[model samples]
Target: MPRILAIDYGQKRTGIAVTDEMQIIASGLTTVPTHTLIDFLKNYFEKEKVEAVLIGEPKQMNGQPSQSASIIKGFATHFSNIFPEMKVVRVDERFTSKMAFQTMIDSGLNKKQRQNKALIDEISATILLQDYLRQK
Candidate 1:
């Protein structure tokens, strides 16, 4: 089976994660600049047998869409338009970033490491992928 890919979309940087061919074990792929995300995905799709993409959808405490939500939605639309063969799904990402930061702290990452927002983004992508897999 083709693998599943997940994206933690951010304004400046986008984190990427992927599942194995069997759709198990979501792992961090990389963090890339937001502007280059579409090109990056195009290249990655050419190289990998990707079936679908899961993007993180941000929401507020009252269940309203966050500021970043529109950007993510735009990206998701562009992604779908560009790669019509692949399916795109948006998963609610409420506390994945906070959870990733706390996980980094619990994993004994130093202060400097914890300060790396890209790392947290990547971890959040992983978390989002795991959540998608669980639902499946």
Candidate 2:
């Protein structure tokens, strides 16, 4: 099976992760500026056999749509338009960033690394992908 990719979209930065060809494991790919994410994914999908894409659907504690949801929805629309061959899926991303920070702390990352928002994005994407894997 073709590998799957996950996107953790933020206003300033975006985190990326990908599944193994077998779709069993998720690995952090890279972090990029939000403005450049589409171009990056375009290039990546051209070179990699990506079967689907997963985007984190940010939501509020009350289950209302978060402010970031609009931006993510726009990205999803553009992603589908750009890569009609690939399927796009959205997964709940509540508290994924918090989980990412906890994961970093548990992994012994120091204060500096733990504070790095870029790392959080990557971990968030991984969490999103892992959740997807679990549901499958």
Candidate 3:
């Protein structure tokens, strides 16, 4: 079966995650520059069978769309235009950064490593994918 992919989009960098071919387990794939995200996804889709793409939807504590939500929407629109056959879903992403930090601590990452924004983004993507899998 094809895998499900998740994206944690950011202004500077974007995190990517993917489920196993069996669609059982989700794992962090990589972090890429925001400018190159489309190219990265294009190459990835060409090499891998991705059934769907789940994007982290940033929301405020009160459930309103966050400032970055607009940016994400724009990206999603472009993504849909490029890959019309692929399914796209949005998953709420509140406190994902804090969760990612805690995950790093639990994983025994040092302060310096934990401070890496790219790593945090990757972890956030993983968390997003896991949550999506759970919902499924």
Candidate 2 vs. true structure, TM-score: 0.96
What is candidate 2's lDDT per residue for 21-66, written digit by digit as tens?
Answer: 9999999999999999889988998788998899989999999999
Model 1, which residues run further than 4 Å from truth?
none
lDDT of 2: 0.93
- RMSDs, each prediction? 0.9, 0.9, 0.6
Model 1 alpha-carbon miss at residue 81, Å: 1.1
Query: Candidate 3: misplaced stretches above 4 Å?
Result: none
Which prediction has the highest TM-score against the true structure? 3
Predicted structure with the largest lDDT when compared to the true one: 3
lDDT of 1 by residue, 14-96 (tens): 99999999998899999999899889998999899998899889999888999988988988888888888888888999999
Off by over 4 Å in 2: none
Model 3 clash tally?
A: 0
Query: Where is model 1 poorest over a 10-residue stretch in terms of lDDT?
Result: 75-84
Candidate 1 accuracy as lDDT: 0.92
